[model samples]
Target chain A: MSEFLIASLAICGTFAIYHIALWVHRTWNHSLTAPVLVATTLVIVVLITFRIPYETYMVGGKWINELLGPAVVALAYPLYRYKDTLKKVAAPIVAGTLLGGIIGISTGLLLAQWAGFEATIVYSLTPKSVTTPVAMAVTESIGGVMPLAAIFVMIAGIGGVLMHHYVFRLFQVDHYLGRGVGMGSASHAIGTATSMEVNQLEGAVSTISMVMSALVVSIIAPSLVQLMM
Target chain B: MEKVGKMIMHIGLLYIIFQFGNWIQRTLHLFIPGSVIGMIVLFLLLSTKLVRVSWIEEGANYIVANLAFFFIPVTVGIIEYYDLFLGKGSLLILIVLVSTMLVMGGSGFFSQWLMRRKEWKHE
Candidate 1:
């Protein structure tokens, strides 16, 4: 078998296992995010321990990452369709995103500082709430670790998924717009994805928030890092 | 011929809106993205009855419905970094997990507070 074909099968096999786990858990009224992340990490660990080079994994896995761009462009339709509600809350959406972005970054930096994490790691972390591409760029620009930024993005996603419901209840944030913006600003894409499962309004609002948060972070992270430097 | 023209016009206008949105962000010196600014512009146009919602619904819905599929390529890129993650991955994981929880909690609380303030103003 050709290398590409073998790599493709391995990728498919990984996804198959992920989906099967998802299905089994769903039957019991459970979620797949936590388990899938844990499982993926475990599998990766085993692969690494066995001395499997990451480049070999990329032969097939790169195909999946290429799809993110078009997916973002695809979001335009929902935003257009739901323009009315979005307009009604535009002020709040902008306001909420700004506030959320500042708080998310500042809080992370402060906590990391309090814990005595290295400055470079802290810089890598400041953009954790944004999506991967943007976060990676921010990290690189600020002289931080790109791989660490990617991991931080995933952590933000899973964090949003795990705590969003409880946070909403605790804060009495019942409105779709508020909930969505909060998720997007805090968790980035993963939070935005899970928001879609809740409702279209949440999804749309969260999408806007995610994009806005990334933009906000792109502008501010560099300056903030400069200040720290 | 007219329908095709209108379809072309619609796409053209959307592209313009997207560009204009970016222009506004740059012009205003805001921290937000041009696409988001475009979303806001489109939403404003729709809300004020300048552009009917039906006009862009088809294109907009098409984009939104399949947002998940778009991220597949990026996620696949994770496979490339598997080795780096394999070494000292625990420290990386710990940082991500802890910081994420902090971001979500902080953002959620702040949003809720802003919502309450908005409600108070109405009352």
Candidate 2:
């Protein structure tokens, strides 16, 4: 097959599966039906079953990835909408996120080191808490493997969404802002989407936290790595 | 026709802002991602009334709402590293899950604590 034909099929197949997963999520209201997770699983299954090369599937996948850059840029809309609320609580949000970013990177690095993982694995784990693009960039700057960093980031995002409700209930955290900030700082985009399901306001706050977490981590991660070394 | 026109215009504006951001990042050698700089540019444009929020609100909301869909392809690309993950996948999963919970708990607790303290001071 021509690359054009294969790429088109890959894109169409991904969109079709993703919309189906969205429909399933709406009908069943199940968290596991998160469109990204479902689409990823289905795509992997098809590729493996058909013995298609990952590179072939990526012919179209890269196009979709390109769109992600703009989608992330779109996040500024919510940040703009919620500017008033964010200003009101700006001090606490900044302080909390700064603390969260520091604690997250340190613990991951320390744990990986104590566990005796290789340096590359430890480097990859350093940026696992932020969104994939920023995380991958920070990983590279800090001498980590890019793909491993991406996988670690995806795992963090998915795990944060899955554990958020239980964590909140256990901690008796009833504050919406707190919930949104906590999830966003820890899980990034997926957690923000999950927050949106419960409340628009929570989702808006999450966008801020996610963006702020990325900014802060990118600024400080290199310095922290130097400090560690 | 009007809504469609507005949507196209808004998306075009966003792309321009993103391009500008990329330019800035490259010139300054900033470590931050270009899209994030684009976000700040959009925020500033809207806040300063240089661009009306309503102009882009519909398109931006549509994109943000479907944000996960945009990430699907890049995520599926993870399959390219299937071999690298096989040996250490379980360990990675454990570490990710544990650290995620810790970050969530730490941030949530801190924010909640500060909010309560502020409320107490006011009352």
Candidate 3:
């Protein structure tokens, strides 16, 4: 079979497995997003390990990733629809975002350093809380590896999913708006997805946070890297 | 004739807003992108009651909701680097998995804590 066809089959097959898992675990009410993303990527990675080229995976996965832009554009509708509430929280949103951005980058760098990660890895880790495109660009500008940035982005997403609830509880962040913004800013898309489950207000704030975080990190990270170096 | 002129003016305003956003980013050395600055501008205008959100809602929504589509070209670039990912595939996988969990958990916790602090201040 053609490589594209094989990759398509692989992606589809992986999704099938993910859905089946969700079905089996439906009674438990667990999330299927993380599992699906991790499983699909894992399956593809395993295939690559056996000499199935990444080009083949890209042939299929490319289509999936391509949808990221339009999905982002779609966020405008909700933002507009909820402008009233958004307006009320505008100051806090921006403030929270700036603080979150600073804390996220600083904490990651410190922890990575404390763990004895190499300098290159430490630079790559700085943008983990940001979205992929911004993080990738920041990574490249600072001489960090692009693929490593991608890995970091994915890790950030998974982390957002697994620990958001516990964190929310621990911090006593009961307000839906604050919770959503925190999640979206910190975890990007994955956190936004989790926010959606909480409430529409949370979802909207999360979307805002995600987009803002991307823009903030992209512009800020490069300069921060230069200064730190 | 006047209404048509007004409509033209509104379009011009949006163009200026976008440019202004870009200019601010370039001039002020802000860490955020121009488009985002433009977004903040728009948000501010709406909040101050200077401009109605309805005026830009349609366009803004279109961009935000479908933001994911823009990443396609970038991801397609992944095909070019297939070899690199393959060469260190396992290590990459491990890093991605571990770091993602850490970022998600850490950030979530930190933000939540900040939120609580904010709440406490209010009380």
DockQ of each: 0.25, 0.66, 0.14
**Candidate 2 per-residue lDDT over residues A8-118, each given as its tens digit:** 999999889888878877887765666667767888899999999888888998988776666667878777787887788877777777877987888888778777889
Q: Which parts of model 3 are misplaced by more than 4 Å? A: A7-11, A14-26, A31-55, A222-229, B1-123
- Residues B1-123, candidate 2: write the lDDT tens digits: 988888888777777888888899999988677887888888888889998988788888777777778777766766776675567667767877888888888887788788888878999
| Candidate 1 RMSD to the correct structure | 6.2
Query: How good is the docking of model 1, by CAPRI class?
Result: acceptable
How many Å off is the CA of B20 in candidate 1?
16
Candidate 1 vs 2: which has more lDDT:
2
Residue A14 alpha-carbon offset, candidate 1, angstroms: 5.7
For all the candidates, what are their Cα RMSDs to the real structure? 6.2, 2.4, 8.0
Work out the iRMS of candidate 2. Answer: 1.8
Per-candidate count of clashing residue pairs (backbone under 3 Å): 16, 0, 39
Between candidates 1 and 2, name the one with more favorable DockQ: 2
What tens digits encode model 3's per-residue C-alpha lDDT throughout B32-121? 545456656765676577877556555444334323223333333444545545644445435444444443444445555555666688
lDDT of 2: 0.81
After superposing candidate 1 on the true structure, give the runs of residues whose Cα lies further than 4 Å from its correct spot: A7-26, A31-54, A170-172, A226-229, B1-92, B116-123
